[model samples]
Target: MRNSMHHQAGFSLIARVLHWLMALMVITMLFVGAGMVATVSERHAWLLQLHKPLGITILLLVIVRIGVRWAHGTPPLPSDLPLWQRLAAKLSHLALYALMLAMPLIGWTMESAGGYPVILFDGVTLPALVEASPGLYSTLRFMHTWLAYTLFLIVQLHLAAALFHVLVRRDSVMPSMSTGPLPGAKRSKG
Candidate 1:
């Protein structure tokens, strides 16, 4: 028999790993992005190089994450949730997934418009997608900034909800994502 006591219907091991890993990367990217916005010195040049590749990596990870989530459904919300609350949860998650995928593409397009090389770590580089156009760069940069701000707000909401589930509601939702499945989540037989 499967260890029903141990696993929650939260996420697969691969999914969980990628989820948290991407979370860490996103947070780091946010900090680096803030630094890039403020600093204009040789010291910050390395961050500029790191930013593009890091974003591209996050984009790839999000693609994998979406695939995993599609293959294995997300754990259902707590039964006590109202219909609207549940709907909000679903919408919030969808928004997060969308932004996670979109931000990098916008950043890439912005970089491409600026005629910058999409250099990865260890000297690998991607081809430029477009000639430098100050107009397109400005527009894309604005979109990327706004989208990131929206992502930041949504993430704050997501984190607050997670904390509420763990601390106030004392529900399994937190544990499902934090560790594994809840105590009573059923395992799907493939």
Candidate 2:
């Protein structure tokens, strides 16, 4: 009789790298954004410089990440996970990808409306997405800030869920995102 279990490898190397890289970039951007709003000092300008290019870079990487995700479908959740967890996981991931794409775009539009160019690394400038307008800038700035905070909250929740999976359930979800071999892929015969 054949065993019911199967061995499934973890995510591909490219997906793992992109996941970690985006995670780091998102965390750093959140901190820098907080700092940018907290102070009126010259450091704000420096942070803005970092923020613009970083946002642009994230935009580019996310575009590539989408392609990678399309080519390599997401790893499946464990079969035993509860319905609520599976639902939450799916919805939360969708939200994350949407926010990751939206925040940078909103910021770009905001800057464009504010008459600021997205000067990327080494003076690589991105064209404006919209005509400069003070009122439009205000609206986009508000939406961007609101979305950033929402993204931050959702990211915290995602992190908490990952920790719960690792520490509480001790599941394979967390391991699947890493560079190492998938744990417990081989099931022992009864």
Candidate 3:
């Protein structure tokens, strides 16, 4: 009973940890990406090294996060949230998940098309997933940039929504993901 209560109150421990860890990682990746494109210094190479591995790490974590979400499921929204808001929540979450999967793949493909190898860490390299071509590289790079900007916007929307829940709404929405026990651990109303 005590065990179940904790699990029901919020996201699983693993889920919470992954959510925050990935959140920080994604945000950092965004900044690193921006810095890489905005600079022309030797540090640019340093940023690229960090960005590629970080993106790949995120790519892998998101896969595990999806699996956790699938196996454990999400907590309910505030019971009183409007239908439109609820729909928006669903759509936005879908967009987030899609972007999480797409962005890294696009980055990887862009590197591959540019005839560059992605080193995961310590001389470990990920295989190139596409044929090398400067033309293909340019297209992939453009697509990656646009998708990244889209991700940035979507991330802002997500943050705003979370803040709304924490401040104005004063609901359990953010707590479900941020702090508390697993989502389904709470006892039933009956």
Model 1 lDDT-worst window of ten: 1-10
Overall lDDT per candidate, in order of appearance: 0.81, 0.83, 0.85
Residue lDDT tens for model 1, 57-157: 99999998988876676665666777987878888988999999999988988888977777777678777767889899999989999889899889888
User: What is candidate 3's lDDT per residue for 117-187, written digit by digit as tens?
Assistant: 77877879999999899999999999999988998999999999999988999777777787774345354
Off by over 4 Å in 1: 1-8, 41-43, 185-190
Query: What number of clashing residue pairs does each candidate have, in the order they appear?
Result: 2, 0, 9
Q: For residue 89, what is the lDDT in candidate 2?
A: 87
Off by over 4 Å in 2: 1-7, 180-183, 186-190
Clashing pairs in 3: 7-182, 7-185, 8-183, 8-184, 8-185, 8-186, 10-181, 10-182, 10-183
Which stretch of 10 consecutive residues in model 3 shows the poorest summed lDDT?
1-10
TM-score ranking, best first: 2, 3, 1
lDDT of 2 at 168: 97
**Cα RMSDs of all predictions?**
4.4, 4.3, 4.1
